[model samples]
Target: MNQIDTGLVKRLIGEQFPEWAHLEVKPVKFSGHDNRTFHLGDKMSVRLPSDAAYAPQVEKENKWLPILSKELSLPISTPIAKGNPSEAYPWPWSINKWIEGETVTKQNVRDLSKFAAHLGSFLVELQSIDASKGPIAGAHNFYRGGLISVYDEEARDAIENNKDVFDETVLKHLWDLALQSTWRRKPVWIHGDVAPGNLLVKDGKLCAVIDFGILGVGDPACDAAMSWTFFDKSSRKIFKEVLQIDEETWNRARGWVLWKALITYDANKISNKIVAEESYRVIQVIVNDYGR
Candidate 1:
């Protein structure tokens, strides 16, 4: 992952697609961790994988985004051009049609409950789309739609290491609850990283989803993680009703949120206070919600 500044983007565009060589290549304010995104003029954006681990997502999105876009009403990332590997950059990249709207946040949304329900419905539509030919959960998408058990050891280690910081007994109980069942029905599509940064809103309404680096077809529980990570009790209830997931699946979803938060907490608790606090807060939310 080289420093993905405007200059590198300029050279890549200039060498590859000379037609848009002169367009201003500026960094999007919230460019994500997996990919380096820069606005390619007004209508499009250039996204390059930030590391080898994320490089494969460019091709995966290029193949499936258009098909998924057709089935869902909300705008997902749409690839307009596939950039080749050049001397300026090593890995293949993408030129996507820029979707408008800022990333979602509690302060920015007009009505929290409505936003939650709306996002839930959008996810329902995404799941309903045909995924017969879609990629199964694996390393490419970080096993998002697969079993939360894939990271069992890592999650356990995080919890054990942070026992002094977190309630070990409660965290262990939640972890066991997650392994209670498998996705019994047919597999469905999932937006692996359904976080605030990936969701987009305009004029206080959720309108688009971006950054499908972890997109895959499998257990929908991974997508349900936002229920605890992002939403409050009332909004979580509305969103849950729309998803209509059963208790067993919901338990797995709880596990999905807990696992990530545990690891995030373990990694950042010392150096980054804000993220650590939020991750701890998310864990407590899951704990309290389960207790009731």
Candidate 2:
């Protein structure tokens, strides 16, 4: 694990908010693979990239998060600067008004109906945001370690190299299904990673979503695909109804799940047992349905 210099984090925050100089600044650990997030009192926060590769997308969030906060009604982290002094921070960074909430858990899934309504309203509001004015141009071609072509022959070379961790037959099946089901519809702005962790719950209702670093314009199904991560069939039905996803979009959503599952399996080859198991589960569900 690369060590994050909390001194640098403190220095950056101190420079960004000089008035809060005496407020306690402590480093807090959060679950995420890409960006570094920290709490700032009860009403604000800051995030920095652990990987330099995401610098561009980090900048995009700095530019577009405010627009989404304004025109869209969903709870979002609104960017606030210390009175136009944003450039004071060393790398591209943004300060967000602290949204009070907690990460929805697996137990929360039992209340799928309530979660569905919250998630449904959020997606509907997100899809309503006009894509024409955002600073981001098109698909987030560079996010997710920039592996948009998840099934390219060359892409699977490492997995092929180590045949033990991956099943060649299952991999091939998922690849074929994904390629055949690629999107044919018009692209729109999407919150690319709508996983449960990004969702915020307060008072038994979803209050807001954070982590816009993966926001982009793409097949809206990329957002809907999260159903596999956070919802079951009944809850997903409510999700689909709210988003108005059609048959083709459903296929593309399935493709999104397959590609993301493969990526997760590949990246966590050595570290996470849970990710590997979940990847198999996603594949099983997809293959069973596709076989039907």
Candidate 3:
């Protein structure tokens, strides 16, 4: 894979978009996991997929974001121009109008419950969009809205490997409970990756949403996974009230959270203490919730 840095971005611009090549190119402070983002002058930003796996997102965002933005009240990353593959980069990239805000964090948010309400409303509006032509969940999204059971093997493996560290019996019980229910209604659009890194905060509120690499129409349960890791009990309640999703769907969402936490802990158990501990904490959150 080619290095996704400012120098490469400058070259891509100078080659493909010479009209704006004179503007300086610099790296954004918090570029996300799927795409490497850089500042293109002061008003626009350049975003390139870090791997072929994310290449399809360029087209998806170009097609849907503008449509979604018009109906959505908050700001979204809408593409201005798309750059084709060049000698330096293998996949397509995008230049987008910059959205000004800070990445969301619990510390920066003024009121967790209020922020949750605002976020919940945004999600409700997103789901309300017409999905008659939207992409369905599959490989491009790592099956984010497909089925949590697709990850059953991975989660069970993690449980087996970490028996000494975690209560395997408790985890298995929760896993069974999670898989017992599944989505049985009409599908809706989902922001496949709803983590904090994809959310933007301004004035201590969720002001904008970026990074739509996993946007698609599918089971909405995956979008609710954050309820466990990102929100407190009260705030989670507020968010749940807005979605009005069924209890069975919420169960599958718990399975979604559990799968990610399990693999994450298994992978980093020996390499990074902080990440390993945090993953364990997320798992414990699910376990405690299940006991209720």
**Candidate 2 clashing pairs?**
43-98, 44-98
Whole-model alpha-carbon lDDT for candidate 1: 0.92
| Model 3 misplaced stretches (Cα beyond 4 Å) | none
Compared with the true structure, what per-residue lDDT tens digits does model 3 show for residues 112-188? 99988998899999999998789988998899878778888998999999999889898887788778976666778
TM-score leader = 1
Reference-based TM-score of each model:
0.98, 0.82, 0.97
Compared with the true structure, all predictions reach lDDT values of: 0.92, 0.65, 0.89
Candidate 2 residue-wise lDDT, 1-292, digit = tens? 3244555556666766677655555554454666676666667666666666554666677678877888766678677752222343334755668777778776644477768867877887777777665433244534321223554554366446435755667666555544565454444577777887788777667778888777776567677765776576678778888888877667667766776676776677579979878876876666665565
Pick the winner on TM-score between candidates 2 and 3: 3
Shift of residue 158 alpha carbon in model 3, Å:
0.7
User: Is candidate 1 or 3 superior in lDDT?
Assistant: 1
Of 1 and 2, the candidate ranking higher by lDDT? 1
Which residue pairs overlap in candidate 1's backbone?
A: none
- Lowest lDDT sum, 10 consecutive residues, model 1, at 1-10
| Model 2 misplacement above 4 A | 1-5, 82-90, 135-151, 154-174, 181-186, 289-292
- Model 3: worst 10 consecutive residues (lDDT sum): 177-186
The candidate maximizing lDDT is: 1
Candidate 1 backbone overlaps, count = 0
